[model samples]
Target: MVISFLSALLILAGLVFFLGAGVGILRFPDFFSRMHAAGKGDTLSTLLIIAGFALYQMRDLGDSEASVSAVLVALKMLVIIAFLYIASATSTSALAEAGWEDGNDPVIAPKHENRLAGPPESRTAAADLNRNSTHDSQP
Candidate 1:
Protein backbone atom coordinates (compact mmCIF):
# COMPACT_ATOMS: atom_id res chain seq x y z
CA MET A 1 0.00 0.00 0.00
CA VAL A 2 2.75 2.39 0.91
CA ILE A 3 4.70 1.64 -2.22
CA SER A 4 1.65 2.12 -4.37
CA PHE A 5 0.88 5.42 -2.72
CA LEU A 6 4.42 6.67 -3.18
CA SER A 7 4.36 5.61 -6.80
CA ALA A 8 1.12 7.43 -7.37
CA LEU A 9 2.50 10.55 -5.77
CA LEU A 10 5.60 10.45 -7.94
CA ILE A 11 3.53 9.90 -11.06
CA LEU A 12 1.36 12.86 -10.21
CA ALA A 13 4.39 15.02 -9.63
CA GLY A 14 5.65 13.92 -13.01
CA LEU A 15 2.35 14.89 -14.55
CA VAL A 16 2.71 18.35 -13.03
CA PHE A 17 6.10 18.72 -14.66
CA PHE A 18 4.60 17.60 -17.96
CA LEU A 19 1.93 20.25 -17.60
CA GLY A 20 4.54 22.89 -16.81
CA ALA A 21 6.50 21.93 -19.91
CA GLY A 22 3.43 22.14 -22.09
CA VAL A 23 2.58 25.58 -20.80
CA GLY A 24 6.15 26.77 -21.18
CA ILE A 25 6.34 25.56 -24.76
CA LEU A 26 3.15 27.38 -25.60
CA ARG A 27 3.85 30.59 -23.71
CA PHE A 28 7.54 31.08 -24.42
CA PRO A 29 8.36 33.58 -27.15
CA ASP A 30 11.06 31.72 -29.08
CA PHE A 31 12.81 28.54 -30.02
CA PHE A 32 15.52 28.40 -27.35
CA SER A 33 13.09 29.07 -24.52
CA ARG A 34 10.68 26.44 -25.71
CA MET A 35 13.52 23.99 -26.09
CA HIS A 36 14.64 24.75 -22.54
CA ALA A 37 11.18 23.96 -21.27
CA ALA A 38 10.81 20.83 -23.33
CA GLY A 39 14.26 19.50 -22.57
CA LYS A 40 14.30 20.01 -18.82
CA GLY A 41 10.65 19.31 -18.09
CA ASP A 42 10.38 16.36 -20.42
CA THR A 43 13.56 14.74 -19.13
CA LEU A 44 12.77 15.22 -15.45
CA SER A 45 9.15 14.20 -15.79
CA THR A 46 10.04 11.06 -17.70
CA LEU A 47 12.61 10.15 -15.11
CA LEU A 48 10.22 10.68 -12.23
CA ILE A 49 7.38 8.73 -13.80
CA ILE A 50 9.64 5.86 -14.76
CA ALA A 51 11.18 5.83 -11.32
CA GLY A 52 7.71 5.54 -9.83
CA PHE A 53 6.87 2.56 -11.95
CA ALA A 54 10.19 0.98 -11.14
CA LEU A 55 9.44 1.43 -7.47
CA TYR A 56 6.04 -0.14 -7.93
CA GLN A 57 7.62 -3.12 -9.62
CA MET A 58 9.72 -3.76 -6.54
CA ARG A 59 6.58 -4.17 -4.45
CA ASP A 60 6.64 -7.87 -5.20
CA LEU A 61 10.25 -8.52 -4.38
CA GLY A 62 10.57 -11.87 -2.59
CA ASP A 63 11.88 -15.37 -3.06
CA SER A 64 9.61 -16.52 -5.89
CA GLU A 65 9.21 -16.61 -9.68
CA ALA A 66 6.98 -13.54 -9.70
CA SER A 67 9.54 -11.67 -7.67
CA VAL A 68 12.22 -12.57 -10.15
CA SER A 69 10.08 -11.29 -12.98
CA ALA A 70 9.38 -8.10 -11.11
CA VAL A 71 13.08 -7.57 -10.60
CA LEU A 72 13.68 -8.08 -14.31
CA VAL A 73 11.01 -5.59 -15.19
CA ALA A 74 12.43 -3.06 -12.78
CA LEU A 75 15.85 -3.50 -14.35
CA LYS A 76 14.34 -2.95 -17.77
CA MET A 77 12.76 0.24 -16.54
CA LEU A 78 16.11 1.40 -15.25
CA VAL A 79 17.64 0.78 -18.65
CA ILE A 80 14.90 2.81 -20.26
CA ILE A 81 15.48 5.66 -17.84
CA ALA A 82 19.18 5.67 -18.69
CA PHE A 83 18.49 5.60 -22.41
CA LEU A 84 15.99 8.43 -22.21
CA TYR A 85 18.33 10.60 -20.16
CA ILE A 86 20.97 10.45 -22.87
CA ALA A 87 18.62 10.48 -25.84
CA SER A 88 16.50 13.41 -24.70
CA ALA A 89 19.49 15.61 -23.92
CA THR A 90 21.17 14.70 -27.21
CA SER A 91 18.04 15.35 -29.24
CA THR A 92 17.32 18.67 -27.53
CA SER A 93 20.86 19.92 -28.15
CA ALA A 94 20.72 18.78 -31.78
CA LEU A 95 17.44 20.57 -32.38
CA ALA A 96 18.63 23.74 -30.66
CA GLU A 97 21.80 23.74 -32.74
CA ALA A 98 19.76 23.27 -35.89
CA GLY A 99 17.55 26.21 -34.98
CA TRP A 100 20.59 28.38 -34.21
CA GLU A 101 22.15 27.47 -37.54
CA ASP A 102 18.87 28.38 -39.20
CA GLY A 103 19.07 31.86 -37.69
CA ASN A 104 16.47 31.61 -34.95
CA ASP A 105 17.38 34.06 -32.21
CA PRO A 106 16.45 33.68 -28.56
CA VAL A 107 14.28 36.12 -26.66
CA ILE A 108 16.70 37.94 -24.41
CA ALA A 109 15.43 40.21 -21.67
CA PRO A 110 16.61 41.91 -18.49
CA LYS A 111 17.08 39.95 -15.30
CA HIS A 112 13.89 39.61 -13.23
CA GLU A 113 12.01 41.25 -16.06
CA ASN A 114 8.51 40.21 -16.82
CA ARG A 115 8.09 39.14 -20.39
CA LEU A 116 5.09 41.45 -20.67
CA ALA A 117 6.85 44.18 -18.71
CA GLY A 118 8.62 45.27 -21.83
CA PRO A 119 7.11 47.06 -24.79
CA PRO A 120 5.63 44.45 -27.12
CA GLU A 121 8.24 45.22 -29.77
CA SER A 122 10.98 44.50 -27.29
CA ARG A 123 9.82 40.97 -26.78
CA THR A 124 9.46 38.40 -29.53
CA ALA A 125 9.51 41.06 -32.19
CA ALA A 126 13.06 41.90 -31.26
CA ALA A 127 13.98 38.26 -31.58
CA ASP A 128 12.42 38.26 -35.01
CA LEU A 129 14.39 41.34 -35.93
CA ASN A 130 17.61 39.70 -34.80
CA ARG A 131 16.81 36.60 -36.74
CA ASN A 132 16.17 38.61 -39.85
CA SER A 133 19.46 40.42 -39.51
CA THR A 134 21.33 37.16 -39.03
CA HIS A 135 19.52 35.63 -41.97
CA ASP A 136 20.40 38.57 -44.17
CA SER A 137 24.02 38.33 -43.11
CA GLN A 138 24.23 34.64 -44.00
CA PRO A 139 25.53 33.88 -47.49
Candidate 2:
Protein backbone atom coordinates (compact mmCIF):
# COMPACT_ATOMS: atom_id res chain seq x y z
CA MET A 1 0.00 0.00 0.00
CA VAL A 2 2.75 2.45 0.92
CA ILE A 3 4.74 1.74 -2.21
CA SER A 4 1.68 2.16 -4.40
CA PHE A 5 0.90 5.46 -2.72
CA LEU A 6 4.43 6.69 -3.22
CA SER A 7 4.34 5.65 -6.84
CA ALA A 8 1.12 7.58 -7.42
CA LEU A 9 2.55 10.66 -5.75
CA LEU A 10 5.72 10.43 -7.77
CA ILE A 11 3.74 10.08 -10.96
CA LEU A 12 1.72 13.17 -10.12
CA ALA A 13 4.85 15.15 -9.32
CA GLY A 14 6.43 14.09 -12.59
CA LEU A 15 3.39 15.25 -14.52
CA VAL A 16 3.55 18.60 -12.77
CA PHE A 17 7.16 19.04 -13.68
CA PHE A 18 6.47 18.14 -17.31
CA LEU A 19 3.58 20.60 -17.56
CA GLY A 20 5.62 23.33 -15.90
CA ALA A 21 8.41 22.78 -18.40
CA GLY A 22 5.96 23.15 -21.28
CA VAL A 23 4.75 26.44 -19.85
CA GLY A 24 8.30 27.63 -19.34
CA ILE A 25 9.21 26.79 -22.92
CA LEU A 26 6.26 28.73 -24.28
CA ARG A 27 6.69 31.71 -21.96
CA PHE A 28 10.44 32.19 -21.88
CA PRO A 29 11.74 35.25 -23.73
CA ASP A 30 14.83 33.73 -25.33
CA PHE A 31 15.84 30.59 -27.13
CA PHE A 32 18.66 29.75 -24.75
CA SER A 33 16.53 30.23 -21.67
CA ARG A 34 13.65 28.32 -23.16
CA MET A 35 15.93 25.52 -24.12
CA HIS A 36 17.47 25.64 -20.65
CA ALA A 37 14.17 25.22 -18.86
CA ALA A 38 12.84 22.71 -21.33
CA GLY A 39 15.93 20.55 -21.24
CA LYS A 40 16.48 20.51 -17.49
CA GLY A 41 12.89 20.38 -16.40
CA ASP A 42 11.78 17.90 -19.00
CA THR A 43 14.73 15.65 -18.32
CA LEU A 44 14.02 15.63 -14.61
CA SER A 45 10.34 15.05 -15.22
CA THR A 46 11.05 12.21 -17.57
CA LEU A 47 13.39 10.63 -15.07
CA LEU A 48 10.77 10.89 -12.39
CA ILE A 49 8.11 9.39 -14.62
CA ILE A 50 10.40 6.56 -15.61
CA ALA A 51 11.25 5.84 -12.01
CA GLY A 52 7.60 5.90 -11.03
CA PHE A 53 6.63 3.54 -13.79
CA ALA A 54 9.46 1.21 -12.92
CA LEU A 55 8.33 1.10 -9.34
CA TYR A 56 4.71 0.52 -10.31
CA GLN A 57 5.66 -2.26 -12.64
CA MET A 58 7.89 -3.83 -10.08
CA ARG A 59 5.03 -3.87 -7.65
CA ASP A 60 2.85 -5.64 -10.14
CA LEU A 61 5.53 -8.04 -11.25
CA GLY A 62 6.74 -8.73 -7.71
CA ASP A 63 8.55 -12.09 -7.60
CA SER A 64 6.58 -13.11 -10.64
CA GLU A 65 7.26 -9.82 -12.43
CA ALA A 66 11.01 -10.36 -12.04
CA SER A 67 10.99 -12.59 -15.06
CA VAL A 68 12.85 -11.93 -18.33
CA SER A 69 10.00 -9.79 -19.63
CA ALA A 70 10.20 -7.50 -16.62
CA VAL A 71 13.95 -7.19 -16.95
CA LEU A 72 13.58 -6.31 -20.61
CA VAL A 73 10.98 -3.67 -19.83
CA ALA A 74 13.21 -2.06 -17.22
CA LEU A 75 16.14 -2.16 -19.58
CA LYS A 76 14.06 -0.50 -22.27
CA MET A 77 13.13 2.25 -19.84
CA LEU A 78 16.81 2.88 -19.11
CA VAL A 79 17.54 3.12 -22.82
CA ILE A 80 14.76 5.65 -23.22
CA ILE A 81 16.26 7.82 -20.46
CA ALA A 82 19.65 7.75 -22.14
CA PHE A 83 18.19 8.65 -25.52
CA LEU A 84 16.23 11.58 -24.11
CA TYR A 85 19.32 12.89 -22.39
CA ILE A 86 21.27 12.95 -25.64
CA ALA A 87 18.43 14.39 -27.68
CA SER A 88 17.71 17.21 -25.22
CA ALA A 89 21.38 18.19 -25.10
CA THR A 90 21.70 18.21 -28.88
CA SER A 91 18.53 20.23 -29.39
CA THR A 92 19.67 22.79 -26.83
CA SER A 93 23.02 23.14 -28.58
CA ALA A 94 21.33 23.66 -31.91
CA LEU A 95 19.18 26.36 -30.38
CA ALA A 96 22.19 28.26 -28.97
CA GLU A 97 24.25 28.16 -32.16
CA ALA A 98 25.09 31.58 -33.65
CA GLY A 99 26.25 30.59 -37.11
CA TRP A 100 23.17 31.36 -39.11
CA GLU A 101 22.72 30.51 -42.77
CA ASP A 102 23.55 33.44 -45.02
CA GLY A 103 20.30 33.61 -46.93
CA ASN A 104 17.93 31.15 -45.35
CA ASP A 105 17.50 32.78 -41.95
CA PRO A 106 15.16 35.67 -41.28
CA VAL A 107 16.70 39.11 -40.84
CA ILE A 108 16.14 39.08 -37.08
CA ALA A 109 15.19 36.91 -34.17
CA PRO A 110 11.55 36.91 -33.16
CA LYS A 111 10.64 39.17 -30.25
CA HIS A 112 10.04 36.09 -28.14
CA GLU A 113 13.55 34.85 -28.81
CA ASN A 114 15.28 38.19 -28.31
CA ARG A 115 17.44 38.68 -25.22
CA LEU A 116 17.38 41.88 -23.21
CA ALA A 117 21.01 41.54 -22.22
CA GLY A 118 23.20 41.87 -25.27
CA PRO A 119 25.86 39.26 -25.95
CA PRO A 120 29.03 39.06 -23.90
CA GLU A 121 31.00 41.33 -26.22
CA SER A 122 30.10 44.97 -26.76
CA ARG A 123 29.00 46.54 -30.04
CA THR A 124 32.57 47.74 -30.72
CA ALA A 125 34.04 44.26 -31.00
CA ALA A 126 31.07 43.13 -33.07
CA ALA A 127 31.43 46.12 -35.39
CA ASP A 128 35.14 45.51 -35.72
CA LEU A 129 34.57 41.88 -36.57
CA ASN A 130 31.78 42.80 -38.97
CA ARG A 131 33.88 45.41 -40.72
CA ASN A 132 36.85 43.09 -41.01
CA SER A 133 34.71 40.36 -42.49
CA THR A 134 33.08 42.71 -44.97
CA HIS A 135 36.45 44.15 -45.94
CA ASP A 136 37.84 40.67 -46.46
CA SER A 137 34.82 39.73 -48.57
CA GLN A 138 35.33 42.62 -51.02
CA PRO A 139 37.37 40.49 -53.43
Candidate 3:
Protein backbone atom coordinates (compact mmCIF):
# COMPACT_ATOMS: atom_id res chain seq x y z
CA MET A 1 0.00 0.00 0.00
CA VAL A 2 2.73 2.41 1.00
CA ILE A 3 4.84 1.63 -2.02
CA SER A 4 1.92 2.08 -4.36
CA PHE A 5 1.05 5.41 -2.78
CA LEU A 6 4.59 6.67 -3.13
CA SER A 7 4.79 5.49 -6.70
CA ALA A 8 1.55 7.28 -7.54
CA LEU A 9 2.84 10.47 -5.96
CA LEU A 10 6.04 10.43 -7.96
CA ILE A 11 4.26 9.72 -11.21
CA LEU A 12 1.79 12.48 -10.56
CA ALA A 13 4.60 14.90 -9.83
CA GLY A 14 6.30 13.93 -13.03
CA LEU A 15 3.10 14.58 -14.93
CA VAL A 16 2.85 18.02 -13.39
CA PHE A 17 6.32 18.83 -14.57
CA PHE A 18 5.48 17.61 -18.02
CA LEU A 19 2.47 19.90 -18.08
CA GLY A 20 4.65 22.81 -17.05
CA ALA A 21 7.05 22.02 -19.86
CA GLY A 22 4.25 22.06 -22.39
CA VAL A 23 3.08 25.42 -21.10
CA GLY A 24 6.60 26.79 -21.26
CA ILE A 25 7.00 25.66 -24.82
CA LEU A 26 3.82 27.48 -25.79
CA ARG A 27 4.14 30.59 -23.64
CA PHE A 28 7.85 31.35 -23.62
CA PRO A 29 8.92 34.30 -25.72
CA ASP A 30 12.00 32.82 -27.34
CA PHE A 31 13.69 29.61 -28.49
CA PHE A 32 16.24 29.48 -25.68
CA SER A 33 13.59 29.89 -23.02
CA ARG A 34 11.47 27.14 -24.51
CA MET A 35 14.45 24.86 -24.84
CA HIS A 36 15.52 25.57 -21.29
CA ALA A 37 12.08 24.60 -19.99
CA ALA A 38 11.85 21.54 -22.22
CA GLY A 39 15.33 20.23 -21.37
CA LYS A 40 15.12 20.70 -17.63
CA GLY A 41 11.51 19.65 -17.22
CA ASP A 42 11.81 16.64 -19.50
CA THR A 43 14.95 15.32 -17.84
CA LEU A 44 13.64 15.71 -14.33
CA SER A 45 10.17 14.38 -15.13
CA THR A 46 11.55 11.37 -16.97
CA LEU A 47 13.85 10.52 -14.08
CA LEU A 48 11.01 10.82 -11.63
CA ILE A 49 8.64 8.68 -13.67
CA ILE A 50 11.25 5.97 -14.21
CA ALA A 51 12.18 5.97 -10.54
CA GLY A 52 8.53 5.59 -9.63
CA PHE A 53 8.22 2.65 -11.97
CA ALA A 54 11.32 1.02 -10.53
CA LEU A 55 10.01 1.42 -7.03
CA TYR A 56 6.62 0.04 -7.97
CA GLN A 57 8.29 -2.95 -9.59
CA MET A 58 9.96 -3.84 -6.30
CA ARG A 59 6.81 -3.34 -4.22
CA ASP A 60 6.52 -7.06 -3.68
CA LEU A 61 9.98 -7.29 -2.14
CA GLY A 62 9.99 -8.69 1.39
CA ASP A 63 12.30 -10.45 3.85
CA SER A 64 11.58 -14.03 2.81
CA GLU A 65 11.23 -14.49 -0.95
CA ALA A 66 12.76 -11.93 -3.29
CA SER A 67 11.84 -11.79 -6.97
CA VAL A 68 14.92 -11.82 -9.18
CA SER A 69 12.99 -10.66 -12.22
CA ALA A 70 11.63 -7.66 -10.34
CA VAL A 71 15.11 -6.68 -9.19
CA LEU A 72 16.48 -7.01 -12.70
CA VAL A 73 13.69 -4.94 -14.17
CA ALA A 74 14.20 -2.22 -11.58
CA LEU A 75 17.91 -2.20 -12.31
CA LYS A 76 17.23 -1.85 -15.99
CA MET A 77 14.91 1.04 -15.40
CA LEU A 78 17.55 2.72 -13.26
CA VAL A 79 20.13 2.32 -15.99
CA ILE A 80 17.77 3.87 -18.49
CA ILE A 81 17.15 6.79 -16.15
CA ALA A 82 20.87 7.37 -15.81
CA PHE A 83 21.42 7.28 -19.54
CA LEU A 84 18.52 9.66 -20.15
CA TYR A 85 19.84 12.10 -17.54
CA ILE A 86 23.09 12.47 -19.44
CA ALA A 87 21.82 12.20 -22.98
CA SER A 88 18.90 14.64 -22.63
CA ALA A 89 21.08 17.42 -21.30
CA THR A 90 23.76 16.85 -23.90
CA SER A 91 21.28 16.83 -26.75
CA THR A 92 19.47 19.94 -25.55
CA SER A 93 22.75 21.78 -25.26
CA ALA A 94 23.83 20.71 -28.73
CA LEU A 95 20.52 21.85 -30.24
CA ALA A 96 20.65 25.21 -28.49
CA GLU A 97 24.23 25.72 -29.64
CA ALA A 98 23.30 24.87 -33.20
CA GLY A 99 20.44 27.39 -33.10
CA TRP A 100 22.83 30.02 -31.77
CA GLU A 101 25.34 29.31 -34.50
CA ASP A 102 22.56 29.56 -37.05
CA GLY A 103 21.89 33.13 -35.88
CA ASN A 104 18.81 32.57 -33.72
CA ASP A 105 18.74 35.47 -31.31
CA PRO A 106 17.10 35.65 -27.91
CA VAL A 107 14.10 38.01 -27.68
CA ILE A 108 15.02 41.04 -25.67
CA ALA A 109 12.27 42.92 -23.88
CA PRO A 110 12.00 46.52 -24.91
CA LYS A 111 10.52 49.38 -22.90
CA HIS A 112 8.12 50.30 -25.67
CA GLU A 113 5.77 47.96 -27.60
CA ASN A 114 6.19 44.37 -26.48
CA ARG A 115 7.03 42.09 -29.35
CA LEU A 116 5.27 39.21 -27.71
CA ALA A 117 2.04 41.17 -27.48
CA GLY A 118 2.24 42.05 -31.14
CA PRO A 119 0.03 40.38 -33.76
CA PRO A 120 0.88 37.04 -35.38
CA GLU A 121 1.52 38.72 -38.71
CA SER A 122 4.09 41.07 -37.13
CA ARG A 123 5.80 38.18 -35.45
CA THR A 124 5.95 36.22 -38.73
CA ALA A 125 7.31 39.29 -40.49
CA ALA A 126 10.07 39.61 -37.94
CA ALA A 127 10.93 35.95 -38.30
CA ASP A 128 10.96 36.30 -42.06
CA LEU A 129 13.27 39.27 -41.82
CA ASN A 130 15.64 37.33 -39.62
CA ARG A 131 15.58 34.37 -41.98
CA ASN A 132 16.20 36.61 -44.98
CA SER A 133 19.06 38.36 -43.23
CA THR A 134 20.74 35.05 -42.44
CA HIS A 135 20.36 33.86 -46.03
CA ASP A 136 21.72 37.12 -47.41
CA SER A 137 24.77 36.82 -45.20
CA GLN A 138 25.42 33.29 -46.44
CA PRO A 139 27.04 32.68 -49.87
Best by lDDT: 1
TM-score of each: 0.77, 0.64, 0.77
lDDT of 3 by residue, 8-60 (tens): 99999999999999899899998889999999998899999989999999898
Model 1 lDDT at residue 85? 95
After aligning candidate 2 to the native by TM-score, how far in Å is the CA of 26 from where it should be? 2.4
Q: For residues 26-65, write the lDDT of model 2, one tens digit per residue.
A: 9987555676778888888988888777666656555673
lDDT of each: 0.89, 0.71, 0.87
Question: Judged by lDDT against the true structure, how good is candidate 1?
Answer: 0.89
lDDT string for model 1 (12-39, tens) is 9999999999999999999989999999
Q: Against the correct fold, how does model 1 do in TM-score? A: 0.77
**For model 2, which pairs clash?**
61-65
Clashing pairs in 3: none
N/CA/C clash count, model 1: 0
Error of 1 at 107 (Å): 1.7
Displacement of residue 82 (Cα, Å) in model 2 is 2.1
Q: Give candidate 3's whole-model lDDT.
A: 0.87
